[model samples]
Target chain A: MSVDAATVRRIAHLARIAVADHEIEHLRGEINNMLAFVEQLNEVNVDGVEPTASVEDMKLKMRDDVVSDGNYAKRVLANAPATDDGFFQVPKVVE
Target chain B: MNAPVRNPKLLKGDKHDWQVVIGMEIHAQVTSNAKLFSGASTEFGGEPNSHVSLVDAAMPGMLPVINKKCVEQAVKTGLGLKAKINKKSVFDRKNYFYPDLPQGYQISQFKHPVVGEGIVTVDMQDGSSFEVGIERLHLEQDAGKSLHDQHPSMSYVDLNRSGVALMEIVSKPDLRSAEEAKAYVTKLRTILRYLGTCDGDMEKGNLRADVNVSVRKPGDPLGTRCEIKNVNSIRFIGQAIEVEARRQIDILEDGGKIDQETRLFDAAKGETRSMRSKEEAHDYRYFPDPDLLPLEFDDAFIAKLKADLPELPDEKKARFVKDFGLSPYDAGVLIAERETAAFFEEVASGRDPKAAANFMINEFFGRLNKEDKTIEQSPISAEQARHDRRSDRRWHDLRQDRQRPLRNRLGRGWRPARGGREAWHEAGDRHRRHRKGRRRYHREEPGQG
Candidate 1:
């Protein structure tokens, strides 16, 4: 799990982000620092203690299971770069 | 229009007992109107960045105020799975840079996942059931979607989904087959739907699965699981597993070592492509999020959640069987989706559970299947179903056979469905209500009148 500089560089490439060489060292440092903090979490005895996923305790306000809104096709695609037949257009991916 | 779906199983040669080690990370979008930690509307379709708040956009001065409802939903999900609720937990910063993530780091539950060990039981067609163990369920915030090819060069980001609440339910490497995995996800989705925590819409990216697939020689230590990224549909996940497993088997069989890496399943290409080396939890450099403090709650609060929890799918399915006298399959199908289950219960209670089940499973649900319509979109009301039972002469004959008015008792009980299946039948046929049966009783068959 120790993210080395080369791994950082590879991750950037795979994630499609352009990272300068000097920044790789900075990324390495940041990753290592984060790992150090995570390492501290292991000291706590969580053998049987359940982990908390959600922070609060309130019910999600239930809505009547009714379809209320449907006439928003134009609104939905208003910012689309390209669209056709009420659907967003993309480079043909399947063909 | 349908495209030819190339089956991967065909190309997968030989039924070798390669230990297929599979794990899953399922992300379910919490059914909430607002974002997880912000008041911004979480509506699906909105203008680009319209739903983005200062907090969601990662503004320097912005702060996150947790949505209490989201937490409750998470707890409800945990409780529904019969998992323990934690008294205290912390949100950590999973730092990774992605254009879609306005904040350089995603706020997620890491070391202390909210829920711990649980089990999901899947019924096989052979009247047997298998139990799959759940490792953990963690919470996180969703990132925006980056739309490439929107223009020749410029990629657009839709913040409508950014900062939405998510529960990442992780499963143990217990599955050995595609069918089992499918059943696991199906059951998990059912439990969530029953709890009213997630909308469970895979097409809209509300629910997605990350499949960890690997192959090992039998009795080999757990193989290195290569995580297949972001399969949005269940069918696609199954297909990805088959393709990835076979690809690995082909490599190992030919003396190639399996590389532990993250791979992407290009559904369009019908293949998996190596993306990069899989990153460990440390690679993200997770730290206690400075913006938020560790979440702490009392047992009383958890008890309240436990108290208010809806009858989970399994319990409800069993209740349908024990109380309503429904077939296990019918009960299972009805409870798989929450609303469908509710609609079935509405139709069944007071009416003969068997007759109501027949109409729901056969008459209403069957017709919907024939027309490729969803139950939510169906025009049928429970009222019309009851009316059909009362008025249809064939139903009356069945009632005579039973020596009692089953439809009458049901109508007397829940008046709406008592009107009968005519209204639902009318939904599929624009003119059926005006043309169909008027007698109050009939046998459950065609041409029985």
Candidate 2:
């Protein structure tokens, strides 16, 4: 699908990325180019191929359900921009 | 003679016979030792952020590995619901920005959920049963808690809940009344608790529901639905549905259109208020996460999980009816919770099930209710109950006569509860006051010490 300026703005907002007004045109062009390059695969005649979610044909690696890590509250909250009485602080969010 | 089945109460309007339809999206926190993709402790009460892992905190280089027990729990829950366990399920990035959610997007199942097409049967108080169709059950990550009361201009985020596993079970719009909706959640919670998948503690925020309520004419096409989000209490869920149905009926009767939007239930006000307009809502850009692989398991895995499944609420209820010869309503009440069912089974083994039901239901439960005590907190022991059942003459005659008072006094030194009801109430008042003073520390939030 072709990308438009308004669509690019929406996409940027959804992704939580700030895009400048002048940068929308450039981003849209780049996105449309990528889509077009991927669309070229439509010309291939292999219709019976199964749709694959990933390139790797493998099972998911799993970890045992055990509490092996944690109890590092200070380290966990070390990078927070703000911290309160033992909690990471942020600007008040309205629902 | 068994009384005729009573229809569930319906809302009567001015002229139109309005019908209420409800659907529920329940978020049940999976019971696991660690978080969904992190090694963070899923323990409820800990120092804030004390249970956080690098992955839970959303560090740059952190990656999520699938927790095998979580997937197995989800599958077991699906089987308990009589739902299909999809062999191949994929996780998607549900993109959104919120302060509590450290990651910009949450890993959830969108199109290909792990469980599909299940059925949940709800038994009503009036000796009636109805089946609610399960659309799907998907595994997702939970967001942290935002404590708004800690500061004025700032909200504190606790990463303890971050990266925890949740099973979002969605139901079809098959419920007809608020009572049915409440019953559905209760039954669903019981099944989940039985499966050991979720603790099903609503007060702890382990289980919360998003109820979709709509109103329509008796035979007219379905009406637009308004979703009330994040209702944590069963009583409030029933109230929300009833209040929302009335609100919609008023709008439709006044010749106005009901907008499809999300609303919040204000328990204190006993009403639902608009939280967001449908037009301004976020369009969550869901896409398959590239980091995670597709979750695929064979039939043998499902069969093994199935083989290990405990007897669910329905199975136990049926057994109670067939073996104990208790009424359907009595059987439902006895088997509502696994602990209560087990307690009853142990006390009633080799004894008259109907007599046991009577003693347990009328005498034990009545005393517990009067004492304002839960089954877990009951002072009476099962051995005491068995002893009372055998030696007490009142128990042998309680079957043929309904008016006979239970002569067996609970505990060692306690007096008979039949004639001392008033005295007990007075003592109960004193005990309640004493307990109230001690309850201050226990009243804190589940995760807060």
Candidate 3:
């Protein structure tokens, strides 16, 4: 949609992005371009046409309900920002 | 539609043909020991830069070494999706600039994906079934996560997600409503979970979707759609589609225009805002990596995969409905999550199926959710496992901590409290008599006893 300058600023604030005032003009173009592309779908006769999500008609295969997990204590702990003897270290809960 | 779609049902508040044309691109984390291109551990929640290998970090001298396991996983995921598994697939660079992307471009599959043409039929809570089309399932490496919450001054980057194998499952737009979109994503996640290919945890960022949405009149053409990027949860996807569709309809009917760009979903306000313009595949200038060769698989291997294929969710759901005499809807719910479905079978088989299904769905799941635990963490037992967790844990340790102890001793045959009152009284009497005998023996020989 033709979102206004103020609306663009409001949206940027909502999305928590740092957008400059000059960037607002750029965003307007970018957003306009995107909408134009999606609008192309309007040209196709989709009255009875169903929008497809996937291309096939099958279900997902499954394993025997099992509990498979990692046990590499060292491996799991290897990338910890901070570690104790065998655990990830966090700030102590108690004073 | 908030727009001028002349649907009688919508007038009556049905929005039925509020037909949500939902399509999804589900990014599922592939289960593997290493990343797609490097030997870095494919794990979740690691410190920044730790899980990153030379290739992931885009080292000057580094070369891409395709992880065969990741490739196999992509093929396996394809097989599970009933898609055409392409043995000959090439990796291309999805050119994009993100702070989290160490390589500045994602190593993704373009024209040649490992899996092609799969379909998911989401049986809604209602009796109707909606078929969502699967376009292609490709292999790619995940970018790092940007942790914005921890600090206002600095955005921390966690590369633990970097190089992790991901199967980007793209779908054809077949959804007719926001509910259908949610259901489609839910079903897709269930399938992925069933295959044991992904953990399918959206909150943990293991699985996510980039939602493409639009609106059109029933007989008129499709409207210019907007792409809502990287929505992490199904509920949010549904919300985003609804908001976006309404916005498009409003704009079109109001003589305004819909902008085609990557938008962000504000779950708090239930709206989508523009993020950036969507880029074409050509914009990325996709080209095959010279460092890796196109993989080719033999027929024997494919046959092996087919033979080794486990009972999928549909089969299991149908079987649960048939063998266990559970309702189709109940079976679907039971089988929606893989571990829960397994727990249901272990509890249902050779026991009261109705009771088992009820407990698995109601009590077990309720408690687990209350405790904020996953089905993978559920402490429920499988009926077939002869020994308990101790023995299985030993086996896992012996297997070098790969296999897991897959059960808790919520042993079958524990009759419901209300139904087995007589049996409970009888057992109590017997236990009391045994205790009396023990007391007598202790009085006769206290120290010896």
Best by DockQ: 2
Highest-TM-score candidate: 2
DockQ versus reference, model 3: 0.03
lDDT of 3 by residue, B1-449 (tens): 11223222221112324334556788888888777777677666654456666666665687766766666677777887788888666677776556567576788888788788877777776756756668999988888766554543445555667778889999887777776777777777777777788878777878888988876666556657777888887767777888887777666666778777778888888888876434432256576755555656777768876777778888998888888788887788777766667766775555567655655554444434433345564333344222222332232233222133312322232333333434334544555565533222101111110
Clashes of 3: 38
In model 1, what is the error at residue A3, expressed in angstroms?
12
Model 2 agreement with the true structure over A40-64: per-residue lDDT tens digits:
9777877898667667777788999
Instruction: Indicate the residue-level lDDT of B423 in model 1.
Output: 51
* Candidate 2, TM-score of its B chain: 0.88
Off by over 4 Å in 1: A1-95, B1-16, B277-282, B390-426, B429-449
| DockQ each | 0.08, 0.76, 0.03
Once superposed on the true structure, which residue ranges of model 3 sit more than 4 Å away at CA? A1-95, B1-19, B149-154, B277-282, B358-449
Q: Which docking category, incorrect, acceptable, medium or high, applies to candidate 3?
A: incorrect
True-structure Cα RMSD, model 1: 9.9
Interface RMSD of each: 9.2, 1.5, 12.8
Comparing 1 with 2 on DockQ, the higher-scoring candidate is 2
